[model samples]
Target: MDRIQEIVDFWFLPESDENYGKQREVWFKKNPDFDAEVRGKFLEDFEKAEAGELLHWSESARGSLALILLFDQFTRNMFRDSPRAFAADGKAREIARHMLSCGFYDELNTVEKQFAALPFEHSEDMDDQKLSVKLFEELGSGEALDYAQRHLEIIERFGRFPHRNEQLGRESTKEEEAFLKTPNSSF
Candidate 1:
């Protein structure tokens, strides 16, 4: 119990631009003593969010934190704490729809805001999908679609983002190292 509380406190500390992102990555990815139960709780809440279980984040700071965790994991390809029994069933679309309509996301940290687009990115709705294609077409003879496709393909190849290597203190592979050198490495 004490250990769990300590972890929670560590996570909830007031975030600042001063190495906050690096500190967070180290704590989350490097801490060997991290409590699994706390992580499990985070994952369970993420599952709840994906299942389209509505949460009133404005009414509860804890709930808002869980929302942040869900978005955080999505960016890293950790969609759920545990693997789902079935594939996504448009529940993410529903959750994304709700999040877009809510004001709660305005409260997230800066780096977290970078992943704020995950829900929209994974939205499988036909209309949304059509819009993405339409937008690409509207860019007419431009490189928008090509660039977007290449980036998406890279993500498909690497479950997690390769651009985050330096940020996360991870060693870059030769391919990633080469990719990182290109202007198209990251946006």
Candidate 2:
């Protein structure tokens, strides 16, 4: 299979309890091998996709999701702890919004929809955070909804994610510093 198909297949495995647990393990945990694999396999495609050269991928739901994964998820793994990790966030958010506007988002399963909604959830913008909460709620994703709500609450209080201060080079406020000490303050 092509790289895009490979990503789609790996990410959207058949829905089963064991598969879901494995998916969460990959999604939430840090694994150097998996990170290295994404870096080695998809880094070039990620660059091309970020440059807007892969517009054709938006022609279908699966393809669009793959593009989003490249922009949002893979970037984090490939460029961890650098500002470059967030460089493609705007493109990811754009693709996600396009997917929603084009009705492609409705074609996704719950797990897929959660990922498609993640760009918004990851945004610092309040409106985007609100939309993320709404989307998670609509999807009936209990854990995701809880996190989305927490993200929205943080955005409401701080205007931006304080956890990003160190990586983005923005100085955190004293209050933000205290909040950062709390567990789960940063997603």
User: Among these predicted structures, which one has the highest TM-score?
Assistant: 2
- Candidate 1 local accuracy as lDDT? 0.45
List all candidate RMSDs to the true structure.
Answer: 10.2, 2.0
User: Which candidate leads the pack in lDDT?
Assistant: 2
Candidate 1 stretches greater than 4 Å from native: 1-17, 21-41, 47-54, 58-65, 71-92, 106-109, 124-187
lDDT of 1 by residue, 1-187 (tens): 3322332344544344355533355423523335444455455555665655635542433354345445443323332222231134244344444444675445545343333333333333344544434444544424445644554556656644467666556688888888778786664
**21-42, model 2: which lDDT tens digit per residue?**
2346777667888888879988
Q: What are the runs in model 2 whose C-alpha is more than 4 Å off?
A: 14-22
- Lowest lDDT sum, 10 consecutive residues, model 1, at 77-86
Model 2 scores worst on lDDT over the 10 consecutive residues at: 14-23
